[model samples]
Target: MAKKADKYFKEDKWKIIEEGFNPDYGMVSESIFSLANEYMGVRGYFEEGYSGNKLIGSYFNGIYERSEPDYNHYKGVADFTEYMVNSVDWLYTRIEIDNEQLDLYKSDFEKFYRELDMKTGILTREFVWKTAKGKRIAIKFERCLSMTEVERSTWQASIKALNFNGKIYVTTGLDFSNIHRNSGENMWNCGEKFIQADKNITLGIEGTTINTGLKVSSNCKIQADYESMEEIIEDKLVAVKLCINLEKNKEQKITKIIRNLTLKDESQKEEYEDKKAKIKDGRDDVIVLNEELKEESRKWWENVWKRSDITIDNDIENQQGIRFCIFQMYQTYNGAVKGTNIGAKGLTGEAYNGNAFWDTETYCLPFYLFNDREGAKNLLYFRYKTLDEARKRAEVLDCEGAFYPIATISGKECCNLWQHASLQLQASTAVAYGIWFYEKMYNDKAFIKNYGLEMLIEISRMLATRGDFDKDGKYGYYCVMGPDEFQMMVHNNCYTNYMGRFTLKYTIEKVKEMKEKYPKEYEKVVKKINFKESEMNKWKQIIKNMIIPYSDDTLIFEQHDGFFKLPHVDIDSIPISDFPLYNHWSYDRIYRNDMIKQPDVLMFMLLFNSDFTKEQLKANYEFYEPRCIHESSLSPSVHSILANQLGKEEEAYDFFGFATRMDLDNYNRNTNEGIHTTSIAAAWMNIVYGFGGLRSDGEILSLSPTIPKNWDGYSFKLTYNDEILEVKVNKEEVTIKTLGNKLIEIKVFDKVELINDEGYTYKFT
Candidate 1:
């Protein structure tokens, strides 16, 4: 309920809002953030100017992996761990007002604020400035949403002068080197720009990459110039115009235009102009595709509302928060490749250098599986697409089976052994867990056998080969660094042990099915791996009885064996200033403390949702919530969701809000770098799986709704078993609806199952 009085992002549902005078900086993000799903997406970003901490990452579904110089020791082993740096960011141009850089932070400014309105979809930024001559001015900016180009996007900004007015200068140009080292790993090479531009107004700005000419699939032209009393127009590949007007004691308005062009058409300038004319005249053009894009966005969400449960009620602000969370998550999924999973920031922020991690398997995919099962299925396909690379990764390591990349923009294992570079085993299970989630969400024998089963088998193969068994009759999977980064060189991690159990079960089952059904695939894989029948026996033995450390003394799960030998410190005693102590505290300090950057056992419990008993889930949630430092951007939301499910309402609210408001409130004080996309997606999952309680376990779609007190009511849709259903939930009751044709059943509160509902209402969990 405190969230109601809090001055922060107060939306509980996702709505497309329309607005004007949206500042370019926020608009670029809003537009980029105003992403959609139809197999691809990119947050619309400004191609020019002083946008703070902007990393405009545009990614294609399943189109990653740089095979050139293998980052992993493996040579041309079909690495799926590489996330290639692909396009040009036209949104970053330096701003020098009167030759004095108008660095907003360093100015004698009175008023400054920014807003990203998802309702109607617009971005706005406002600021008051006292010029060098002591003249006061106000600036308001806005940008438009582009459903026009699915991959390409557009943005615009308006500047104004209020009170004392004076002539001001604004500069717009593209910033090319926004790429930073992800996870502070390898030094990434800033690819060259073949296209060059030099203050040529008539032609706008244009250039080609020096080396990466065709690497990028799309080309875009974005331009902005200060508006005077009239409109200034420039024509070349795209139309760009700046409109500025001065009001008496008010402000000035400036707008930027971004035009997306097709890379397939490498036509001459005249050809592009002719195409533009035809488009204007209603010829074969992108405008039609644009229309479909809008339908896709609407239809996508509409279909989503069909089966997903909604738990928050009337408090529109909280309602907006929930929808916005889910909407953002939907925007992040690209579905074509396994390596092409959502980022830490989920396309919302450029921070974390926009790399994929355990977050995808551990947090994201489950939400997608129940609500958007097709998308979830595609996530598995992504892993399968990279299976060759996984195997090649093994070859490079002189091992059998696949070893997926820890962090990558492309599918290759680009992560060096540093931060989580050491948690390579977690990355391996990411694919393995994804396979498990798929099976849990959809027990479709055809889907599993025809598609998922193979990928599962391959990934399971990776674990079987990668995991070393101990001598004791009780089997243990080894050589894995657990979630506790401080406690390195670990063995018998409970999480890894569980993953091996899951892998072995699925791998053995899938492999056996293939051997019976698709003998050729079974024979080929067997020949390729030189796998013996005894291997299946080994997997069965290990899976049936893997040793997991239990602490009857504490009634909590140990991170792994020998974890009790480590010291314990109260996480709450730590000060906020020492946030991100992972870098400040000695590894020993962390190892000795009862703090964690993210979930270890809890992660396993959530990902393998049905595996743990409710009491176990509750116990883990209570014990870990207190000690969790949430230093990792991906932490709070997960705990929030779990807490909500366990009736830890207050804890759930805090964590959920923390996840939602992280960047907006600067909760972690790290927003200056960029928003945490991975955490943002986790925040959404915390809502869907935690509060909305939507989980599909191979057959039954289940719901356990619990709205935070601050939220009035929330509603969402899900596409389950080809049926479209919508669920609305509030403090008191929940509603369900079927938007698509199909007779299907869904478990409400993990108890009642609803069948073929045109719409149905039931008591809330």
Candidate 2:
């Protein structure tokens, strides 16, 4: 039987709440209550230490460790694999009362409650513990990562004696002995340790593998009303001990302020060495207090909500779901640093080895494009910075131009599977699509001319070299895998060919525009890359003849050339135990039938929505929806958006619920690994693009708003042409108003309308 959804979190508009603790749900709760700034993230492991089932995960954004590849005789396989290594436990703590240690699993406790507040980015938990001698004590823990200062975090605990006066001992420090759950090995070597008992501070440095050349320095300051203090130092650990006296009905508070500095550059290594000397001489580092950090993060989130919040009326479940999605989206990335991309797990867990997949461009970019244009540009700029590595990868595959990796971190192919590493073309094409989409949304020709055009041309060249004309004069890719991993090594996968055509066409158009608009700069780029006019002709011819499988009788495109000949399998008939079919069925049994792992044809249609007719969309969605198993987390949101377009209101809402709570409720039963970072972004898309009816594919931005029957009204914000447009949808009509002074024209229900300082409202027919 399939595992039932675990709905442990209570529904609230601004918080994710757990009424009582359950040891069985320990790991799941750890992932659900995780916290992160763009620089680092920590799982919600217990500070006082829990001996139950849990994965203690704390990760830095770009820090990773490399492993030697398994010996394989086959060519074109990766020679090394890199993983985002598990880092320091900045919240490591131990507590003792009346000479009895505290461990959540062994202790007697009651009134256990935990909450993650989305409004303020803080996690709070409180409970009352009974000691061995019957002394009663209440403790509350609060922690938050600083959004304003990316490197700082604060952990605070407030304690009070309920019945009798007692003494409490606390040990807190940074531990570098964290083991990676997947590899079961410690990946860091402790380099330096410093402790100052008089100052109540501790500091340590840890270094990763030599290949990564990365080191992290953690500085911590302790503040508490203590009668005495002591310093302890050990291999890979440095700590401070405090003894505090408590009176009946009086609360005592202890706070720890932590700052982490990473050294990734050779020049910075020298500077860090100099700073280490000063630290041993008792140099005090500046520390921001707990309240100061919390207030700053609150104001940051306040501005973020003003521009990106989605307000829904008469629906509490979706209200909390959508806010959690938006909150995680911003927490994962906000363009604070360059040369960094959102990983599959987004620093939440150690799944997918922290490598970024095609989902970054296909699922995550739209949310950032509409909200933080700079962040969107930074995502594309990562591709530009890694262009050389892409070219080297293409040379290894014997292709003409750049072929981006299917899974990557630090611009290298990291997937050990040969089939996926070599045959998938979506990553290269997705990069091209991202560049085109960014320029279309922002109208930033300067970005296109400087960085985007080079990547586009190279991607187009790879597409041209990778595909060829079939025996019947039709151009298509063979021996490839589409988005649906079920049917691999297929001919002319529809989505691949369609996106390939779009990439080539866009590249040619931009090259011509550059030549006409900025002739001098275009010449410079052309000379730098050694461009030729004949390659342009090849791209144009390929676009003109690219074959996309279609049929007139069914009015739907075949998923691939020979997909119709395969035997059909009724997806609903499969046993629930066999769900996540990859785990249950034989490897070859999955690809023998017509069951799809995810959306294939429907995906390209969604990306280029304006290119397809309504009848085409309805016909394809009807044929494909029944066959999709939604094994991938990226599947349901695509289905939801297309179902909305086809006016299948109930079906769309059902899929929307699945996409929004895929992690919150552990619908997939694998959220213990980490949060599904891309799916979280997709939930935002489900609201703005799915129900609010916003479409940016056409020349003018448009909306065809529809409200779910359960909701009385809904509203969201979109940034277009440097202006903020607030769209409100009710049962009777739709209202759109801009926050800026510029006049804008958009299509509302297939009719053109103009809005300025005032706004435009459209009534239902």
After the best TM-score superposition of candidate 2, give how far the Cα of residue 708 lies from its true spot, in angstroms.
0.7
Best by TM-score: 2
Candidate 1 to truth, TM: 0.75
lDDT, candidate 1, 133-226, per-residue tens: 6656666555433432444344444555655444555544333333423422221222322232333232223323333242232233333344
- Could you estimate the TM-score for every candidate? 0.75, 0.97
Model 2 segments beyond 4 Å from truth?
1-4, 199-202, 267-287
| Cα lDDT tens digits for candidate 2, 575-639 | 88787788899999999989998899999999889999999999999999998988888888899
What C-alpha RMSD separates each model from the true structure?
6.8, 1.9
